[model samples]
Target: MVLGTSFHFDGQGTATAADAMKRYCGLLGEQEMEGKSSPQWLATKELVKDDGEMVFEEGISRFCPNCAKILKSAVEGTYPRLI
Candidate 1:
């Protein structure tokens, strides 16, 4: 099951689901592109779960301080054991 808050459009025009996912996934596809920049958190490798999952910990980066705080709370709430 996926748990997420609403994706922020930052006042950009709304997109169809297909268009949104296409753009989102494209940002995660590869680093060092010509004109697009992915959020650092999206591009980082992460452990999938707490059950002996793969471990990858690059420093956590967020779009902003508020987002980092919110993410911390959500992650701690949902995966208490993983923290």
Candidate 2:
């Protein structure tokens, strides 16, 4: 299990708070898999630089809608989500 920090978004736009949260989580997952750096990772890199230390959990476990194809090919298990 990939353990990582979870993010929260303020409900201020047309999208629901949950939607925003999922979007960001997906972005983070993509960055991790690609070995690419993201704003979130960059900001926290010094504080917590080890990628192995982060584990995807709960909402973070789901694949990004945009990157679903790649994830489907590589990852196991059915993607779980909150209704």
What TM-score against the true fold does each predicted structure earn?
0.28, 0.26
Q: Residue 36 CA error for candidate 1 (Å)?
A: 14
Question: Model 1 clash pairs?
Answer: none
Model-by-model lDDT, in order? Answer: 0.31, 0.37
Report the lDDT of model 2 for residue 72.
41
lDDT of 1 by residue, 1-83 (tens): 11121222335764433343444444444433333223333322222333101111111231123234323433444422221
Quote the positional error of residue 41 for candidate 1 in Å.
Answer: 2.4
Best by lDDT: 2
Distance (Å) between predicted and true CA of 42, model 2?
A: 7.5
